[model samples]
Each structure stands twice: as structure tokens, then as C-alpha cells.
Target: MGKTIAIANQKGGVGKTTTAINLAASFAVLEYKTLLIDADPQANSTTGLGFDLRNIQQSIYDCMINEGQAADVVLGTEMEYLKLLPSHIDLVGAELELINHPNRENVLKKIIAPVKDQYDFIIVDCSPSLGLITVNALTAADSVIIPVQCEFFALEGLGKLLNTIKIVQSHLNTDLEIEGILMTMYDGRLRLSNQVVNEVRQHFEDMVFNVLIHRNTRLGEAPSFGKPAILYDPDSNGSVNYLNLAREILQKNDATKITNQEKILAASDEQRDT
Candidate 1:
């Protein structure tokens, strides 16, 4: 089965959606089946990939509410292995609608379970809130990846998010773990950027990846042009960084596979000896 990861953070302008779009595209380029699930009401990830939001008759909102099946709502893009679950304004009302439902936090998990094995990676771009919608996203994810911007208040909102994760692990989803913390909007020339990086590393240590996403115009411009940085400007620094992040993800997946294989072989040997 594929790994379902939520690229989430409660802070806006932290590159969560951008990371989701670009990373999904990058993974597709690497020959992996990838799905980008837009749970954000704004539908930025959907539009960024050139989808007309109004025309996407069904989206994640409908899937969660049982108005439609999850697989039926997946929209194809030009990329061979990349698909999108588009979002729309209807998503804005989901929090209020889902409040009274039984096992409310699990709605998304149930909706996505049937299709989990169809993709190599499922990336959910969560809304910038700790509300019910985001709770649903967190509840459904196997791992959470936080994108921290390299700014003065970089660590400010992290505590609340960490607390939420603690609650989810203790109550709702015990098996969910932090995938990694990504440092975004890095400005190599600024001393404050370095300071922010040092402070985050002090708290997260090796949990942060070495590849930092520098503040590049192409990253910001691509969305307006309705394309990923990779498709917008293949040689841009933003494109290069996201591609490296994709490589990091695959490397981790490969390591996990090797570890599992070793465990299986050892188990077989034990069975034969018995």
C-alpha cells in the first residue's frame, strides 16, 4: 500500500500546498503513482495544477460526506502518474456539517481506505487550521509532514500543532507518526534565516531534512501561471529543491523496504529452524 502523508501546518504562506503540488508532480516524474488530495477550501493546489475549480463537480468534500465515492472524484492531469482530488468552495462548509457525525474524525479515513493501495503516495494539502477539516486530514494520514518557514516567528505555531498531534496519537490514531519537518522559504543571504534554521534544528535535530527550499520567485510565480515550478521553469531553484525532496522521500521508502525484507527473511529462517 502507498503511504498517505499530510503536508500540514496551521500557518499560512508556509508552502504546504506548494510542496504538495510540486512534490506530487516530482514523484510522478520519478515513475511513482501519486495522488494530490486538496483538503484546503481555497483550492490553491487544485488551481495551481491548472484545474478549473468550478468544473470539478465532485471533490474531497463530497467524498467525506458520502455524496460520492473517492475514486470517482479523482481528476487526471497531463502528467502520466499524477492525479488530483480537486477542492472547491463547498469544502468551507464541511467543518460545520461534519460536527454531528459519529466518528467524525474518521470520515476521511473511511472514504480513502478503498483507494489507498492504488497510488505509491497520497499527499493531502490540509487547510491552515486546527479545526474539524484538518482533524479529519490528520486522522486519516499515516504520517504528518510539517513545513516550517525560515522567518522570525518560525517556531511560534509549532507547539500547538505538536499538541494536536499528541492528542491524535493518544486518542484517535495511535499509529500515526511524524514523517519529517521541512524548512521552506529559506533565504541563504539572511542571517535571520540561518538563525531560524539553527533554532529549528535545535528542537527537531535530524528530523529536518538537509535540503532547504530557498525563497525563489519561480516558486511563487508558478501558481499564478497554473503550473508547478517544475513545469513552469524546469531550471528554477524551486523546481530543483522540490525534486531533491522527492528524492529524499523515495530514499526513505527504499530504506523501509529493505528493512522489511530483512525482517521477512529472518522470520522465514526462524520458521525453517523450528
Candidate 2:
């Protein structure tokens, strides 16, 4: 089965959508069959990928609220290996609509079930909130990637987000894990940025990703052109950082797979001996 990762942060302007777009694009560039699900009502992921909101006929809103199938709504992106389940502004009201539904937390999980095995990675770009929609995304995801801005206010509300994750683990998805905390928009010239990075790393240690996404002009401009940094300017620091991040994630998962396989083999050997 493909791994489902949610790019989540309750705090806005933290580069959550930027990380989601670039990271998913990086995975695609690396030849992984990837699906980027725009779970945020803003539809930034949809537009950032070169999609026009006016042109969308059906979207993730339809899938969640109208029982629309993912296959019908999924759009092929400029990258051959990447696909997108676009979101609509209508999703703003999804939380209220789903409130009374039975097992509403699992709606997104069910929506993507049929298409899960078709890709190597499915990345959900969650809304910047701890509302029901984010809860649904968390419940559906196998893991989450938290993006923290490299600024003075970076650590603020982190505790609340962590608490929300713990609650989801206890009551919704026990298999859900935090992939890592991604540090974004770092400026080496700024002592404040350096300080924030140091403090977050000190607190989270191994849980923080090693690659820091630096502030790049191309990275910001690419969105306006409806393209990822890699497609817009492959040589830019923004593109390079995201590519490195993708490779790091791949290496980590590969190590986990090897460890799991070794455990299975060890178990089999014990069984044979017994």
C-alpha cells in the first residue's frame, strides 16, 4: 500500500502549503507516483499546481460531501508521476456539514481507499486548523509532516498541535505517526532564524528534518506562475532543498522497511527453530 502523509500545521503563514507543493513535486521528480490532495479550502495547492479554480468541475469537496469518487476528480499534473485531488472553496463548509454524519472522521479515509494503491505516496495538504476537516485528514493519514517557520513565533502553538496529534492517536488513528518537523523559510543572515532553528532542534532533536527550506525568490514566484520551484527553476536553493528533503524521507522509509523485514525474518527463524 502507498504511504499517506498529511502536511499539517494549525498556524497560518508557516509555509505549510509551500512545503506540501514542493515536497510532493520533489517526490514526483524522483519518479515516485504521487498524489497531492488539497484538503485546505483555500485551494492553494490546486492553484499552485497550475490548476484554475474556474475550470474545476468536481473536487475534493465533492468527494467528501457528495460521495464523488477520487478517480473522477483527480487531475494529472504537469509532472507525469504526480496527480492532484483538487479542493474547492465549498470545502469551507464541509466541517459543519459532516458534523452530524456517522463516523465522519473516516470520510476522507474511505474516499481515498480505492485509489490508495495506485501511487507510491499520497500527500494530503491539510487546512491550517485543528477543526473537523484536519481531524479527518489526520485520521486518514499514516503519518504527518509538520512545517515550522524559522522565525521568532515558530514554536508558538506547537504544544496545541502536538496535543491534537496525541488525541488523534488515542481516539482515531493509532497507526498515525509524525514523519518529522520541517524547518522552512530559513535565512542564515538572520540571527533570529538561526536561533529558532537551534531551539526547535534542541527540543525535538532527531524528530526535526535535517534539510532547511531557505527563503528564495523563485520559490515564492513559482506559485504565481502556477508551477513548483523545480519546474520553475531547478537550480534554485528552494528546489534543491525540497529535493534533498524528499531523498531524506525516502532514505528514512527505506531504513524502516529494512528493519521491519529483518524483524519478520527473525520471527520466521524462531518459528522454524521452535
Candidate 3:
């Protein structure tokens, strides 16, 4: 089965949507069959990937509310290996609508379960809230990638997010893990930025990604043009950082698979010798 990762942060302006769009695009460029799901009502991920919200006929809201199949709402993006489950503004009402529904937490999980095996990676862009929609995304994902801004108030509200993850792990998804903590909008020249980075590294240690996403004008401009930074300006710092992040993720997963296989082989050899 494919791995489902949620790009989540309950804080706005943290580069969550940017990471989701560019990272998913980077995975596609690397030849992985990837699917990007826009779970945020803002629909930024949908538009960032070059889809016009006004023209969307079917979206994730339909699948979540009207009993529509997730596959039916999947749309082809410009990238060959990248697909998108577009979101609509109507998703804002999902939280209230699902209040009385049974198993609302797992609704998104059930909707995407049927197509989970079809892609190498599925990326969910969560809204900036710890509401039911975000809970559903967490319940559906195998792991979460948090994009934190390198600012003075960066660590603010982090405890709540960690607590939410712990709650989901204990009740909703036992296998859920924190993929990595990404530091975005970094400026090496600024002392405050450097201090924030050092503080985060000191706290999270190896959980923080080594590749920092530097503040770049092109990164900010790419979404407005409806394209990923890599596609918009391949040589930009934003594109380079995201590409490095993708490489790190792939290497980490590959190492894990190798370790698991080695353990299995060692077990088999021990049984034979006995």
C-alpha cells in the first residue's frame, strides 16, 4: 500500500500549503505516482497546482458530504505523475455538517481507503485548525509533516499540536508517526532566524529536517501564478530546498525498508540454523 502523509500545522502562514504543493510536485518529478489532497477549505493547494476553483465541478467537499467517491473527484494536474483531489470553499461547513454523523473522524479515511494502493504517495494539505477536518486528515494519514516558520513565535502553540497528535495516536491512528519538522522562511543572515532554528533543533533534535527552506520571493510568487516553485523557477532557492526535502524523505524511507528486510532475513537464518 502507498504511504499517506499529511502536511499539517494549526498555524497560518507556516508554509503548509506551499510545502504540500511543491513537495508533491517534487515527488512527481522524481517519477513517483503521487496524489495531492486538498483538505483545507481555503483551496490554496488546489489553486497552487494550477486548478481554477471557479471551474471545479466536483471536489473533496462532495466526497465528504454527498456520499461521492473520492476517485470520482480526482483531477489530473500538469505534472505527469501528480494528481489532485481538489477542495472547495464549501468544505468550511463540513465540521458543522458532520457533527451528528457517526464516525465523522474516519470519514476521510474511509473515502480514500479504496484508492490508497494506487499511488506511491498521497499528500493531504490540512487546514490551519485542529477541528474535525484536521482530525480526519490525521486519522487518515500514516505520518504528518509539520512546516514551522522560522520566526520568534515559531514554537507557540506547538504543544497543542503535539498533544493532538498524541491523542490521534492513542485513539484514532496507532501507527501515526511524525515524518519530520520542516523549518521554513529561514534567513541565515538574520540573528532571530538563526536563534529560532537553534531553539527548534535543540528541542526536536533529529526530528527536524536539515534542509531549511529559505525565504524567497519566487516561492511567494509561484502560487500566485498557479505553479510550483520548481516548475516556475527551477533554479530558485525554494525549489532547491523542496527538492532536497523530498530526497531526504526518500532516503529515510529506503533506509527503514532495508533495515526491516535485514531483520526478516536474520530471523529466517536463525530459524534454519536451529
Candidate 4:
């Protein structure tokens, strides 16, 4: 199965959905089957991919609450290889409902299991909070990609995030790993942005990705029209950066091929044994 990652941060306006949608677009461009999970109630990731939010028949809430069938909620996006499991505003209440369930933390994990082997990657755009929804995302994910916006108070909410990850690792899912911490909306012209970048790198060190996404107008504009920067303005710096991120993802996963193969074999054996 391909790696499943949650693009998460408790702090809002840090571009978590932006990164999730664009990254999924990037993966689709590489001919990889990518499923974008809109775990957030805002459903920005769903609209950002050009899916009409108003006319949805089935939503992620239906699947999350066990009211609707899974995978049937998938909507075809403008991109050929990208599919979106759209969310609705009702997802805001899903956390409270999920909390009472036996596998509250792993609600999403169980939902994703049946179709985990179908895609090359599954990217979840988590809500900007440390609530049950975020924990659900963390529990389901194989890895977490943090999108840290370069600005003041950037690290203010991170301690809580790390603690939540730790809690999930210990009690919810042990295989969860930090895939890469990305620095987004970087403005080299601003000293503060650079400072945030440096400070974060000092703490994360090699765990931080080498790539840094600079602020670009096209990046901000694409979502307004419901398109990824790649298709909206393919030549823009933001588009290039996301494409580069896909290449980075491929390279990193390629280096870990042996481990992935072992996982596939193990999964196969488990199926046979069952």
C-alpha cells in the first residue's frame, strides 16, 4: 500500500488544506492514484479541487458516521488520477459523535483500511485543532506532514501538536511517523519569515524538508477559482514547488522501497492466513 499522510497543524490559516490539495494534485500529475480526504468540516480541500460543494449527494460525514457506504462518496475531480472524499459542514459534529465510539481514535483508520491498497497515496487535510477529529486523522495516518507557515507566533501551537502526536503514537497508532515538516508561505524579503524558518529548522533539524514554499500570488489565487496552482498557473513558482514536492515524495519513498515491499508481503501473508 502507498503511504497515507495527514497534512496537519493545530494552528489555522497555516495552509494545511492548501498543501493537501496541491500535493494531491502533484501526485496525480505523476500518474499516481491519490485520494484526498477532507476530514475538516470546512471542506476547503473539496472545493479547492473544483468539486461543487452544494450539490453533494454523499459526504465524508456519512461515511464517518457509518450512515453511508464508504468509497461511494468519492467524487471525480478535474484531475484524472485524483479523487476526493468530500466533507460537509456537518462534520463539525462528527468529533462529538465519534468520541463515544469504541474506536474513536481509529474511526478513520478503520474507514480507510478497505481502500488503503487502491491508491498510491492518501492525504488527509486535518482540521486546525487538537480535537478528536485531528486525533482520528493522526491515528489513521502512516505519517504526518506538518505545514508550518513562516510568520510570527508560528511555533506557538506546535507544542500541543507534538504532545497530541505523542499521545496518538503511544495509545492510538504506533506506526505513525513524522514524514516531513514543510515551511510554507515563506517570504525571504521579510526577516521575520526567515527567523521563523531558522528557529523551526533548529528544533526539527533534518526532519524538516529541504524544500521551502515561498509566498506566491498564484498560490493564493488558485483556490479562489477552485483549482490547484498546477493547472491554474502551471508556470508559477507555487506550481513548480508543489510539483517538486511530488518528486521529493517519490524520491523519499523510493529510498524506502525495501521496507514497503516487506509490508506488502506481510499484508499478503496475513490475507492468505486469514
Candidate 5:
């Protein structure tokens, strides 16, 4: 089964979409079959991967609202192993359209079910809101990667987002957990940025990623050219940081798998002895 990670932050301008694009790209570059779902109506992830929204006939909106097959809408990106489930501007209205549906929260989960096992990782880029759309993303994800901007208001609204995650865990997806909290757009030259990073690390501790995505002009410029940082400029700071982030995620996942296997073997040994 594939691991589904929803990249979310209720606060706008927090580099949520940037992380979604680059992290997924990094996974693909590392030879992992990765799929990115542009759940946000803005479709930034789609465009960031060099896709034109106007050119796409079927999008994630169709898959969620019109019962369109996810496999049919999946588009190939520039990267060999990366794929995208493009989003449309029409997705803005899906929240109201599915408002009355009994299982609205699980709509995305159902939409992506048939194709979930085909990839090693599936990343969803959520809009900056705790609306029905974000709820759907949460319900469909096995884990969440929250990107927090390294600024003065970095901790603001974090409690509310965490509360929302708890609600989703309790009522929707019991297996969902916070994969990690990423510190993005950090500027070492700025005293406040350093303070914000320390504050966040102090609070989240092990939950915070070791890789700090420093504020770089190249990171901001890559998206406009419709390419991820890794593909746009592999030697840039933004590209290097994101690659480190990907490695950290892979190592952590490997450690988790080994730990789980050890537990299973220990149980089997006990059973045999008994």
C-alpha cells in the first residue's frame, strides 16, 4: 500500500504548495513512484509541475464531484516517476456541491482508493483553510506534513490546526498522524527567523524536521517557470534543503518499518516458544 501524505496549513503564504511540489519531485527523482494530488483550487501544484490548467479537460474536481476515475485523470509530469492528479478552478465550488452528501468527508478517500496502491507515495496539497476540501484531504490521508513559515506569527493558528487534526483522527481517519512539521522560509540573517525556529523546535521537538528550508530567491522563482526547484536548479539552496528533507523522511520511514518488523518477529518467536 502507498503512503498518502497531505501537505496542509490553514495559514496562507506558508509554503504549503512549495513543499508539496518539491517533496513529491524529490521522491520521484529518488526513483520512488510518487503521485501528487492538487486538491487546492488554486492549482499551483499543477502549474508548478509545468501543466496548464486551461488545457486540462478532466481534473480532481471531476474525480470528486462527477465520479470521474482518478486513473483516467492522472497526468504524466516532466519527471519519470512522478504523476499528478491536476486540480481545476471548478474545484472551488465542490465544497458547496458536496455539502449535503452524507459521506462528504470521505469523498476524496473514495475517489483515490482504486489507484492508491499503484504508487509508493501520494502527496495532496491542501488550500489554506479548514473547509470541507481540507477535511476531505485529511480523511483520505494516512499522515500530514504541516509547513510552518519561519516568521513572527509562525505559531499563530497552529493550535486550531492541531485541534482540527485531532477531530479528524477521532471521527474520520483513526490511522492518521502528523508525519512531521517542516520549518520553511527561514532566513538565518534575520534574528526573528532564528527565534521562531527555536520556539517551534522547543515546542514540537522530535516532530520538527531537521532540515530548515531557508528563504531563497530561487525557490520563489522556480514555480513561476512551471518547474520544481530540483529540476529548475539542483544546486540552489532551496533544492538542497528539500532534498535533505526527502532523505530525512525516507530514513524515518525505513526506521519505522524496521521497528514494526521487529515487533512482528518478536511476537512470532513468543508464539513458537509457547
Candidate 6:
């Protein structure tokens, strides 16, 4: 089965979508079959991967509202191992439309079920809100990546988001785990940025990712040009940071797999002795 990770942060302008696009692209570049799902109505991920919204025949909205098939709506990207389930402005109204539906929180989960196992990783780009859509994304995901911006108000709304995650864990997805807290937009030259990073690390400790995504001009410009930083400029700092981030995640997951296997073997040995 594929691991589904939602890139979520209730705070806006915190590099949430940037991480979603580039991280997914980096995974694909590393030859992992990856699927980027644009759950946000903004469709930034769709366009960031060189898709034109105006030309999109079907989107994630269709899958959620009209029960469209994910495999049919999925589009191939420039990268061979990467695919995209595009989004549209129509998704803005899906929250209201699904309000009274039976088991509404599980809708996204069902939509992706038919196609989930086909990829090595599924990355979802969630909107900057704790609304129903975000809830749905969280419910569907096996884990979430919270992107925290390195700035003065870095920890402002973090508590609320964590509280929400707790509620989801309690009531919805019990298997859900926090993938990691990613620190973004760091500027080492700014003392305030350094302080923010230190404070967050002090509080979150091992939960935060080691990679610090610096403020790179190429990263910002790539979206406008309809390409990820890696494809746009592989040598750029932004590209390097994201690639490192991807590698770190892979290593962590590999370690987790080994640990799980050891536990299983231990259980089997105990059973045999008994």
C-alpha cells in the first residue's frame, strides 16, 4: 500500500503549497512513483506542475462531488514517475455540498481508494484552513506534514492546529501520525529567523525536520514558470533543500520499516516458544 501524506498548515503564506509541489517532484525525481493531489481549491499544485486550469476537463472536485474516478482524472506530468489529480475553483463549493452527505469526512478517502495502491507515495496539498476540506484531507491521510514558517509569529496558530489534529486522531483516523514539522523560509542572516527556528526546535524537538528551506528567488519564480525548483534549476538552494528533505523522509521511513519488521519477528519467536 502507498503512504498518503497531507501537506497541511492552517496558516497561510507559510510555504505549504511550495513544499507539496517540490517535495512530490523530488520523490518522483528519485524514481518513486508519486501522486500529487490538489485538494485545495486554489489549484496552485495543478498549475505549478505545468497544468492549465482553463484546459482541465476534470478535477478533484469532480471526484469528490460527482463520484468521478481518480484514475480517469489523473494526468501525467513532465516527470515520468509523477502524476497529478488536479483541482479546480469548483472545489470551493464542495465543502458546502458535502456538508450533509453521509460520512462526509471519508469521501476523499473513498475517492482515492481505487488508485492509492498504484503509487509509492501520495502527497496531498491542503488549503490553509481548518474547514471541512482540510478535515477530509486529514482524515484520508496516513500522516501530515505541518509546514511552519521561520518568522516572528511562527508559533502563533500552531496550538490550534495541533488541537485539531488531536480531535481528528480521537474521532476520525486513529492510525494518523504526524510525519514531521517542516521549517520553511529561513534566512540565516536575520537574527529573528534564527531565534524562531531555535524556539520551534526547543518546543517540538525531534518532531521538526533537520532541513531548513532558505528563502530562494528560484523557488518563488518556479511556480510562475509552471515548473518545480528541481526541474527549473537543479543546482539552486531551494532544489537542494527539498531533495535533502525527500531523502531524510525516505531514510526515516526505511528505519521505521526495519523496526516494524523486528517487532514482528520478535512476536513470532515468542509465539513459537509458547
Per-residue lDDT value at 253 in model 5: 89
Worst 10 residues of 2 by lDDT: 255-264
Q: State the weakest 10-residue window (summed lDDT) of model 6.
A: 255-264
TM-scores for candidates 1 onward, in order: 0.91, 0.92, 0.92, 0.91, 0.92, 0.92
User: How well does candidate 3 score on lDDT at residue 237?
Assistant: 91
Per-residue alpha-carbon lDDT of candidate 2 for residues 147-246, written as tens digits (9 for 90 to 100):
9999878988899999999999999999999999999999999999999999999999999999999989999999999999999998899998998898
Local distance difference test values of all predictions, in order:
0.88, 0.93, 0.92, 0.87, 0.92, 0.92
Worst 10 residues of 1 by lDDT: 255-264
Residue 11, candidate 4: how far off, in angstroms? 0.3
Q: What is the Å distance of residue 160 in model 5 from its true position?
A: 0.6
- Count steric clashes of candidate 6: 0
Q: What lDDT, from 0 to 1, does candidate 6 have?
A: 0.92
Q: What is the lDDT of residue 262 in candidate 5?
A: 35
TM-score of 5: 0.92
Q: Per-residue lDDT for 1-274 in model 6, tens only?
A: 8899999999999999999999999888877889999999999999998898999999999999999999999999999889999999999999999999999999999998899889989999999999999999999999999999988789889999999999999999999999999999999999998999899999999999999999999999999999999999988999989987987898889833333433554477589899
Evaluated against the true structure, the overall lDDT of model 3 is 0.92
- Native-structure RMSD, model 6: 8.4
RMSD of each: 8.1, 8.3, 8.1, 8.7, 8.2, 8.4
> By TM-score, how accurate is candidate 1?
0.91
Residue 227, candidate 1: Cα error in Å is: 1.0
Candidate 5, residues 1-274, lDDT tens digits: the string is: 8899999999999999999999999778777889999999999999998888879999999998999999999999889889999998999999999999989999999988999889989999999999999999999999999999999789899999999999999999999999999999999999999999999999999999999999999899999999999989988999878877877898988833333433554477589899
Cα-lDDT of candidate 2: 0.93
Largest lDDT belongs to which candidate?
A: 2
lDDT of 4 by residue, 110-131 (tens): 7888888989899999998989
Candidate 5 pairs with clashing backbones: none
**234 in model 5: Cα distance from truth in Å?**
0.5
